[model samples]
Target: ESGVGKELVAKNIHNSSDRAEGPFIPINCGAIPETMLETELFGHEKGSFTGAYAKKLGLLEIASNGTLFLDEISELSQRLQGKLLRVIETESFFRVGGLREIKVDVRFVAATNRDIKKDVETGEFRPDLYYRIGALTLRIPPLRERREDIPLLVDHIIQSKPEFKHKKLSGKAMEILTNYAWPGNVRELQNVIYRALFLSSGSTIEPHDLSPDLTSGLTVSGRRLEDIEKDHILKVFREVNGQKRKAAEILGVDPKTLYRKLHRYGIDD
Candidate 1:
């Protein structure tokens, strides 16, 4: 759920809406410290606080006439939740340490991986805020549930990387990706693709190019586990310009072990 492309969905919504011409602002509620998050949302006047050297506009004002995406909204503290609820209701808020209330016309898009209903029941999140934001809910399924989309997502990711423009996934490699349980979702898949591209010998990404964790105990191209290990060792060795110590560090093995493996694979140097 963490890497299920929630922000992408929010962007799609904003781009297709009437407010497409306006700024699309996004902030992760969980990432910012509580003290600073308030100022970030409401802005501050010059000399409003110790660091207030110049007037500043907050995300609320910046996203006026547009969309404000609040990622991980459930992480907001109770105080901020109350303030946000007030903003949704009144459509006006004062900047930090400013007396004049500022009005904003902003459409809010909120997302969270947590079970917000449970959180609200447990008194962690405010119910009033939840009701306002939950009017229209869109649930994105995990990668494993929608395995068919992996190929399309993979292609999209590949096309985005300039170096991977000429690279393509082998049929067996694609099968392994689609079948693997992607607990980390699209993020993990992207990382795997990048890793595979770095380790792959040719234009095609084969099953052996994938991280060992993903292909463990799985045979493809009728290659034995030892052969897979040999191929991986040789690839790492070459990628590091035959620097055994660096290759060993990358492979998480000692230099002596890598040397022994190289010898066993009948590879000199």
Candidate 2:
């Protein structure tokens, strides 16, 4: 649930920490590729390897005397966990293909959506690394747990959207949004609002503008092929603003597939 608020919290922690002047580099570990993750975080020296045309500094070196925010820290592989432990313990690392050891002064602030303690117990994650990273831990409760924050978050989201500046949510729509169990968390809420913003022609966003997927709960019963097809088509349609060409570009599908979906869904020109 690392949303706008979580980022703000991270920023506040960094700003208040001793190394306020240093850079605060935020990395989403879960999103980065396993192969490139090392290179991306710990930069390489020129000619260190193929495609290493120029010398690059790693985030750890760049955040010298600063804070490094590692989001989704649990996603790191066992090898990466070992490397990270070494860096944390020694505050030094050798750049890929570089001979010299580079020292850094950095405070790490990591966040994760997984149970790291369980990971450590299961031996998927190193216990020593866990102890190093958890010098300070802040647990951010999910949106459902903090129901009182819903209205405030919704208002902030609406105000943040440029297209929805003039639009307002009807009381009923607002109620629906507030009461719904937000499984996707704050990110899902933002997407729902954005969807409503585009779909609503009037100044007020209504319940009808929301995607059926958001409201409809998927059951254990196997979903129909037609239902899956419709969902995919609808998603692509919304992404491209009902444009066949742009939808094709985004979906990486041929124009014919997009056209077929449009026809299949009975979407009018």
Candidate 3:
């Protein structure tokens, strides 16, 4: 759900997994360059290439007997996907230049924001690899779908903040968060709350603490602004509780203005 928290869900999964005591390495596959991604994941032997001054352990080796979280798994290249499949199937791999194969035991938990099935149909992703990793699929619903969970998520974010102390969300602020689309998902909501926290000077947050993106109506002319604001607001909201007061203050807005919009949206008090 838009207002739901991903970190919370991830943490819950980690705690429940059998490898709870072992290291939990999380990597965003989409963020790294395709060229260096293999090296980053599987590591390279010393003198393997131009930059190989010394031997380095890949995340796979480091996460041996642990949990390896590959976020945005859909971004993996086809070649990389093939290599990964081999590793998963054979339970062994060789370093970039090393002749000897290294074996390891690691549980993989991958996630992606995109429709993986569509990626496969487009030939952008490998279907075999998908089946290998997605043995236990968990589809997290968007925030807009789970309206009831918004309030709880907001409270969780607010309490998680270090500086908020005893601060909390107002009814009006909560309403705005509950109604938002949250296209960026939990990560976006977290950022919006954080921004709101910084903008807030008082003990409680208001809608003004929210980013302008939340208030700006979507239009043909303002589409980019709307997107930017939406992303920012969702991110901040994720960080702070859906409290409009906190969000508004972080966004540097008056609480009254934030309250009015909540009413306009028809969000329940």
Candidate 4:
């Protein structure tokens, strides 16, 4: 889901909009550590803390006259969520320790891979913030669902990379790529192609050059929704060792729902 190029879509929108020439700052919310996420977004002043040797500007400042793309936004903590809401409401924020508030004109574009419907319902994500960020939403389709675009995408990748420019995919390899489920979507495809090119000296790529996972679909790939859900619930239960609050938070389910599921699955305390 991450490799699905959400930022690419956001860039496309910005490039087509009035902010075409302005900077586009993209931040992956899930990649940053939870403890430092706030400071990363709303930078600190010099001597703000032990490591504050010099004052620094945050992403918001960097994208002041441009677009601020927040990827994996669902990973933000509730405290940061409230802070972010305040920034959105005021269009201004203070440096981590400085008293002065800095204002900016920025177009915010947030993306998430989570099940928003479930997250909002479970109270894991703030509904007010959700409405604010999702005022304009666009969903990108996964690669497997767009089989017709494989050839064009492959061509684009091949031509884009210098090492891959001279190489071509064999008919069988291309067919396999086009038909594969592509669990990792376009990003995975790019990786496979790059790997295949790196490993082979020949001008054409073959099926063996690609990852086996692509050719031999896993048995779990065809499982029914209910079976998958059961497996996931069990996995989460085991991961948290039956800690209801933690499990519910991770599963994006309320406590009562988690309790009912525990009873349904007969999971002991």
Clashes of each: 0, 1, 44, 0
Answer with 1 or 4, whichever has the higher TM-score: 1
Which stretches of candidate 4 lie above 4 Å from their native place? 217-269
Order by TM-score, highest first: 1, 4, 3, 2
Error of 1 at 84 (Å): 0.4
Write candidate 4's Cα lDDT for 8-113 as tens digits: 8999988998998899989988899975877888988999999999998988898988999988899998888888999999999998998999998899999998
Candidate 4, residue 244: the lDDT equals: 80
Clashing pairs in 4: none
TM-score attained by model 3: 0.73
- The lDDT per prediction is 0.90, 0.80, 0.77, 0.85
The collision pairs in model 2 are 43-58
- Local accuracy of candidate 3 as per-residue lDDT tens digits, 1-269: 32345445665687788878888888888899987889989999999999899998899999898888888889898999999999999999988888999998988888887889899899999999988998888888886667677677667777897668577767766666766777776777788888887888886778788787675562123234544555565565557768777977887768786566556544415
- Write candidate 1's Cα lDDT for 174-207 as tens digits: 9788777787889989999989888998999998
Candidate 2 lDDT score relative to the true structure: 0.80
Q: What is the lDDT of residue 71 in candidate 2?
A: 84
Model 1 steric clash pairs: none
- Name the TM-score of candidate 4: 0.76
Which sections of candidate 2 miss by over 4 Å? 1-8, 16-20, 214-269
Best by lDDT: 1
